[model samples]
Target: MDPGEPDPEPGRIEVLRRRLAQRHGERLFAEGALGPRRDLAGVLAYVLALLVHGVTVALVVAGLLLVVLGWGQGALPVIGGLLLGFAVVLRPRFGRLPDDTPVLRRAEAPQLFALIDEVAAVAGTTGVDAVVVAADANASVTTYGIRQRRMLHIGLGYWEILTPQQRIALLGHELGHFANGDTRRTAVIWNALHSLALWHYFLAPVPEPDLVERITNWVMTPPRWAVYGLLHLLDQLTLRSTQRAEYLADEASARVGSTDAAAELMDRMLVLDSVEVALQRESVIAQTKGGAGTRRETEQGLWERLAARVESVSEREYERLRRVSVLRGHSADATHPPTHLRRRRVSEGEQWQAAVRYDEERAHAIAAELAAARDRVARVVISDTAC
Candidate 1:
């Protein structure tokens, strides 16, 4: 099949299986290379990371040395240098890791854990340490602990909309990140880049709480500029590498599930995301009409009602909405690639028979099993904590 064209043949699954086998035999992903250019980019990303970290070390050492030298000079110099050194030392650099979401324990939902284990085993990784649910319309796998314990986060908003097949595809794609080493490779490098960018915020020459810090801010401005400049350079070089990683993860989804299912999931996610905006608007309107006390009444039959509302949307209307949707084009700095590109990449694989399928029964079973936890989470997510 042509790269741009869809595969309609009954043997599409068999074709994909052969392609995956060929890729394995050739070890195309051994060093994380889907193409020669991507391989070169991967090497460049590591080299860039090392160079950036070296500069950070130099800055820290320089700060410490200044502290020592200033101490030898005089009290005023010592105070200034010591304070500046501390700022450099203590300024946080890494992005805030994903940890605020509510946790879902195995005891509360063994069925969900079972599904996660199945996907993780297929992805060739140790099972996840936790399953979390959040208010978002996205699902992801994150790391925690010194051992980098994997945690799976299922966005209940998104979960309510997906079919069984799409759920598997989503989990498979996330686990694929673990399986393909994307998480480990980018963990330190991306964190370093984020830290570099963040140092600017810490050292920015803004008004400070104390007189000493105000003075320290003036001295630290130069380092702040340097960090930001390096951050820009690194982001430019690594953008393609990040995009490639996402593509590989999508390919992994295709391998674990099916290409058609993955593509459909991507397409549906965009539609559902758009539809959710309308749903929220309606929810607000209902709140205004009925009052805050009536919220429970509104939420009682929410999903079934909303699901029907979504299903009632005409295809032409959906296509029209999607044309102007945020999912239309690639985001410049997003962690994932554009939905269209991702859908296309997965769909481009060869046609085969025996494609995997997920029915409504499993989807309902998983949802029913986790319904109680989902309710608690939904309350926390959708309501005011003050009340």
Candidate 2:
């Protein structure tokens, strides 16, 4: 997708919510709101989230009661069994960790983990359980499984382009999500959204030729629309808080890495298109020069070359990208405030001295730890491009 384009997957309801969110986000910033807060909107968000969850819970309980009451009976037991089975479909889904990504362990990357620990301390969040490297030009922190174990995903494309301080800023921003109190990320609220989404998915009308199937779809349509409406309401209620959390995360980035570094990081985000082009160019060059060279020879210093390409971006080019962002209202996504606003806010916020610093020696050690992962990611990039 283009930088400023609305995400296609969200469809119409989310598009409306995004517009409302953008308006509310601008007002929040204008009013100098600092971080997530428990206002009237927040209370409504929680109530709506609980109400969604409560519906599922009530259905399950009713199913279980029917099963018990109808034991050894005929139709009631069968009906209860069906209800229980349907309730299972409404259960919360805790996503699994990526099987294909390179999982970096603390033992394998001590220095890197140490840096993460320091950043977490400064950001006032617990450290991540693991780090995973991917091929995308983005980084994020997410929870997985019932334990909600934290995983930090680093995109080599994004990671390689950042300077050490900027990297710290990036980490600060991601880890800050945990501390920022974004209601959407909370298990109660998130699971409610998940359950409602499942309802929408299962009840959605589909083309069916069989008479019975057509009737079933017809029966399900009303409930499907109802779920859709509830989902829209929950989303709208939480939208402001979600956007506020992002600004708070940006604040954490500034507090941990210093305001200047965080601001520079936002500037770097504006030029991610250049990062992608550089990655593709390097991949193509590697393929062209791959006659008799060994794998190591082809992949060695791949990240360094990419970093150099990013560093070589002229000030004039950076300014041009900034202008384009403003013109386009470019953001990471519809949910996020515009990139230019985030950059401006960070720059204009209180100046903070670096709370966590990485000197040259430590930075080199951390890079050394990432060597194997870097080679693996570089090979993947080349192979993907080849395909």
Backbone clashes for every candidate come to 9, 0
lDDT of 1 at 91: 43
RMSD of 2: 3.8
Model 2: which ten-residue window has the lowest total lDDT?
1-10
Mind giving the per-residue lDDT tens digits that candidate 2 earns over 125-181? 889889999877899988888998898999988998999999999999999999888
Candidate 2 lDDT at 210 equals 88
- Return the top candidate by TM-score: 2
Off by over 4 Å in 2: 1-10, 58-85, 207-221, 273-298, 385-387
